[model samples]
Target: MRRLLLLPAIALITTLTLIAPTHAADQPNFLVFVGDDMTWTDAGCFGNSEVRTPHIDQLAREGMRLTACFTPAPMCSPTRQALYTGLFPVRNGAHPNHSRIHEGLRTMPHYLGDLGYRVALTGKRHFGPNESYPFEFLGKNKNPDFDAIGKFVRDAGSAPWCLMVCSNQPHTPWNRGDAEAYPPQSLTLPPYMVDTPATRKGLSQYYAEITYMDGELGRCLDILDESGQRDRTCVVFLSEQGSSFPHCKWTLYDTGIKAAGVVVWPGVVEPGTTSDALISYVDLLPTMIEAAGSTPSDEFDGRSFLKVLDGSQQQHRETIFAVQTTRGIIKGSEAYGIRCVRDGRYKYILNLNAENEFSNTVSQDGNIFASWKRKARNDPEAAELVESYVRRPEVEFYDLESDPFELNNLAADPTPAQKDRMAELRSRLNAWMAQQGDDGAATEMQALERMSPRSADGYRRWRAQQRRSGADSAD
Candidate 1:
């Protein structure tokens, strides 16, 4: 009887061990720290001397750092829309900020939830208005409060949780007078912008905001560690687009598209590993799905770079694309706008209407109209930056290797070799745009057609009303 009892006990112990969850520990929690209106070199991990982001730097030290990452669009709404839908901004009628993301889109979090991962988002979740257009992926609502994020995670009642945290800071109305903390002279203004006291003064506030953002992220990371989820969590930190600088925010240049990307997955991704893989906003969704051990559907335009995380592949993209939209700047003026294709060495811009009324003037200044106009007059560097705003030839090219600042335009050169490279990039752009269903100025046409007489008249009436209201209020 004793032997028989012992035999059943042994069998029970074996069964319990075998039935334990295999992915309980292996499946990593997901946390994405998205900064609003940040530039490419804003983080300490990305080699910025003025910025002090110790927590973000620590994340890079604990995981893989991705260089050469670009956003699909320069603007926030379209870029975030494309990143979530895994489609180009044009496909969903989100060419610019005014257009909302279409309803019933299959987003990353929407699909991940089906795979047993709990998903949540907090802070600056710019997924367009939910009343007009809803996303299948977002849980609860868009832009959930920061305090609510932790509560949602705890209530998930699951082992692995995915949280998307976006912070809005360092964009505009910058914290002035804070430039004193950073060496004002050491601020490396982009070659396109002038080195002036005002520029440095603006940067000082921007840096302070970045530092403040860093503190917020540090708090979240500390919470994760305290909850014993550090080892089982994968953290990705990046920005939506560039800062509020002239010629960068709304343009396809490095200032607008290129961003600092850092990922941390302890024990899985090797720490201190840096890869120059040309990553884009499109790659984020597919990569996150893969990390969750789930396969994305064929609908996605991006591919998973699991090899890069494992240190097997060195680079991902050889070339990247950029789009610009200026439909609202001028009324009844519809232009197909500028489309650019950039490799590591060169950038080719196709101004669909170079000679017509829809000409692409020095297309770099995408900031607020007030700030942009001021910079052009007061800042000498602004003049050089907006040089392309002038009427251009059908095509323009810049050799980024030698002229990283993009001061010289070589399209006018009579050299045969330069002409050949220009032709090649043009062909590539045309082909890619055609494939994406974004040939020429179709975006501009959509914008014009959609803008009704009522909307236009409403804007005009609102402006006049505002003036009258201001006068009356002052009295």
Candidate 2:
């Protein structure tokens, strides 16, 4: 809750004079590499030995690795919206994948374009619900060829450019029998779930995807090296959300919301400087704008961390926030919506509606805890816990420091003196929601839970745009 307003000149001075060699007019080319559905502990730098993310790990070794970075939402579309607009997903009305970003808002790439930076994107541009508003130059796809990345950077013709490359490997539809590529025995399982052989096998597949994405990252980095822009370019590696997993990915757990972020710029970010400083996905836009000497819009809730790049700023946010969208089905129909928040140590989830009734009873792949349910039916303890979570409690709380796995709930437990802390946090969160004009967003989010991507307003908008395009062609 520290006020940036109190240190006005400090923020200005830090923004203006942080970078050394660059003149007031010189702008650095920007590049953001978004890894799809990646997690903090999955990367080599963060501590997963089995999952090979050598290139991303190398980027961390060469620059700064953020330990406590999180996206506003645990899912892809909402967090991507926040990243582009520097606002919370709820504030932008992009709470769920089916929801569209308000049309007139200036996006990060749009702002850069106005500043004379030729903007181009390659791979997953899942913005505006159905991803309707891709950059005019490049549309969304899986991964851009390494040779193409090099060609684009080299042929930028002395003008500054911004390129965003995204990938979608580590998501769902797990690779079943690739034991040689990713040995199941070598993988580690999170504590929230029982570490069975099946879990390990699933994890192995996710890691295989991680390894594949690492190769892609290496290709892009190699392209930058060959183009001779590696030194001058400011490279940022981040994720839209966490990997798709049970109680992760689409959920609001740390495994679902937190992402690995690393920034490398030879002389700018100090080597091997790891910071636990909190960073929101929303901050990317302002940071890019500030680094390039472009003005950020007043509506932006995020602040630039360019000082952190120049070794002048050590702290980012003291407390970070997070949210997730819920999914549901009603008599063959679908619904979706959600909103939540987290401080550094505790995560507070306020579900406006019950998960079972408000959304689908099954997971993304329609695996309604098939293995877990079988085990739970046999084990009384597991059955009790599963039943509790399934009932869709109004509030959930966890002590991240002690229960990093987030299996134990302190919201209803009186043994931990949690009620007082919970009340204080609830007050703070409610006040924040009100200030953002989202007093009933939690309730509205419940309505969204039952909505599907096909039924979303965003899809309608996309269809209308397509119709207009068709009409213009006819003319």
Candidate 3:
């Protein structure tokens, strides 16, 4: 395992020089590649020698690797919406899966376009209302048209542009890269998982998909290089949200919301640099805006980390917050809502519907959870883990420095110091929700109202069916 060295109030680059903002005509180009369902720890640069991610590794070696980057929500739609809109999920009215933003919300393209830049998002768009996004759509889900990307760059000539290439790899069905490269017996499972043969097999396939996503990222980077704009382009790649494995997706665990963030700003960010500065997805657009030598608006939920990029600042945010809504997702729990807040070390989680079983598609048939249960019948360790997965306490706290995987919950018997920390974090979390107009469980039940037209209708029928079947979700 490769560990990221913690830098203490050091310069972003070796020079420790603060980069002066460039003129509007000389603004650099931006190229962003977002991978689907990839946990930060699995990123080769972050650690994990089992998977292949040469392209991502190269970026970390030549760029700044953000240690505490996170999304506003664990699911796809809310994460993407928050990233683009520069607002938290609830504030944007898209806190649920398959949800849409409020009618008049503006996004990245709008902000960047006003600054005279061509902004386009290609592939795997979970956003909606064309007016809100307004990106020049390029390709379909999972498949970004590389040729079109190259052509778009060539056609842009000297105009500064920001392009986001979204990928749909390593999500589900786990069939992308070559699984043979990673033998099931040779892999070391994360501590949170059960070491069943079925789990190993699924891990192998999931790893292959991760590598496949890296390959796609390589292609996107190659386009920038081929265009001779590599130096003038700031290349960034983010592992958007965690994988759908248990304790990863559909939860507020660090593994679920932690994003793999690497930024390669040529002549600006130092090579092989690492920053422990915490940043949220909502902060990205504001950072980009500042990078373009423009001012970010006060209405945004995030502040620009451009100073952090140029060695002018060390930390970005005081704490990061995330939410999880299970009402509209496929095979998700009826109203199991979760919220979390984390600083550098401690993480606090609140499960609003703690009485309900924490359920998701991960425990469905053919998934790894069933296999764990089968082994749990005879193995006490497996049984304990299986029980812990579905049954969680309402208030959970973990010292992230000591327990990175979050196996031990300190909330059960908190020390005086721990109790004080928890109270502070819980108070901050409540204040954040109040600002977003979130009423905890009540906000969760109204998820369909924020969903896209297509997703809203489907979930309405599903809710109706659940009612007919005597499954009262309290919706």
Candidate 4:
């Protein structure tokens, strides 16, 4: 396993100087395609043979592929807030799902708009508080509108633009594509997943949705080509967080926080290159700021990785952190809180409230969970997986190189060196929590208090109504 060396502040300043700006007329436009609830290895380029993602694979072949990219949060709104603000979810005040950011914190629009760039967001506006992210809203639709996006790009005239196209695909109550195309019997399942009829069927639907998203990506790239901006544009495709399944979406495991990232900036990046630099979604805002020829703010928790993009740096950060809080979930769900720290090869997790059995939206009402339980009745391995999904220990550690699925907990049987490493990771996580003003139990209590008593009841009623109407209620 390769380890990352932490750069000194003075060295970072010097590296920033190496990123020169393009010509005034040739400033690169940024087009970011964010896939909701998609896991790290679902695309064709990421080694999934079952899912067909020709467009994303093509982008990898034409651009730079990041082998390891993680998000600050596994859920939707929290991750989006962190990505736009360059701050962790705890500091941004959107640590819980479906939550808003802090009142006065600025977003990418505020930072990039000051540099004479137009930032616009189309489709899925999961973020809130119009003032925090005052981007020009092009439109909102689950599906892509290539014609309108092309028009938006062309109308920008000579000014550079940053457009975020958020796609609501591969999310649950999956049903958006032709599920018949992906046969459940022929699909390959991950080690963390149980082999059952319902699990296979659910995974096939999810794969179909990923393929649909790929087609939409192809359409967006076509729009860029037709508009003649493909050469001067930086295209980024991000697989946001993980899918909504057991041991994936809501957990702080690698499967939950790790994301797939690909970037294609014509003149700045080499074609068909792969980078093993460690990066987080919070670093994206600062990178784009530097790419647009502007100085990044000192207040951001993330530093720019433009040097990595320019082929001048092999490493970015020595460690990355992730957080999760299940307070605002539906009624009867346990308030599970998790904090994690990971270096290149090892991961350490602290389950803040591990006394209570964990339960969330994903584990309760999905056919996938139903199938897992059904299989658990006859299979001991499936029973263990199901039990581990809900009953977690106070602390867990894993050497990711040896156990990528993180099934084996090494907290109890660490060697002397592993014990020291675990202590170091714990110290780092504690210091980060202090910096973010994260008082674990108190924070969870506050989030719980903020949730109205009627909110959970309302959510239950909404789910019932959706079931009656045959609508998707998997948010």
All models: lDDT? 0.66, 0.67, 0.85, 0.82
Supply the global lDDT for candidate 1: 0.66
Question: What TM-score, over all chains together, does every model reach?
Answer: 0.81, 0.83, 0.93, 0.90
| RMSD vs true structure, all candidates | 12.0, 8.2, 7.4, 6.4
- The candidate maximizing TM-score is 3
Q: In model 1, which regions exceed 4 Å deviation?
A: 1-26, 129-146, 176-180, 183-186, 329-336, 353-382, 389-394, 448-475
lDDT agreement of model 4 with the native? 0.82
Which of 1 and 3 is the better model by TM-score? 3
Top-lDDT candidate index: 3
Ordered list by TM-score, greatest first: 3, 4, 2, 1
Model 2: lowest-lDDT 10 consecutive positions: 327-336
* lDDT, candidate 1, 1-475, per-residue tens: 3234223222321332111234645467888888878887788888787688899899889998888888888777778777766666765546655455544455655556655667666766555545432222333443335456556555655467778787766656666324567766777766666555666666777888788788878878877776666777889888778886655676666778888888888777899989888887888877777777766554566777777887878888878887766553322123436788888788888776565433212232323333444676876556544444434466668897787655677888836877888888888888777666664665555553333344445544644564566621221
Instruction: Report the lDDT of model 3 for residue 193.
Output: 91
Give lDDT tens digits, candidate 3, residues 125-169: 887666778898776655788888988998888788999998888
Local error of candidate 2 at 201, Å?
A: 2.5
The Cα error of candidate 1 at residue 436, in Å, is: 1.6
Roughly what TM-score does model 3 have, to 2 decimal places? 0.93
User: Going through the candidates in order, what is the number of backbone clashes in each?
Assistant: 8, 13, 0, 0
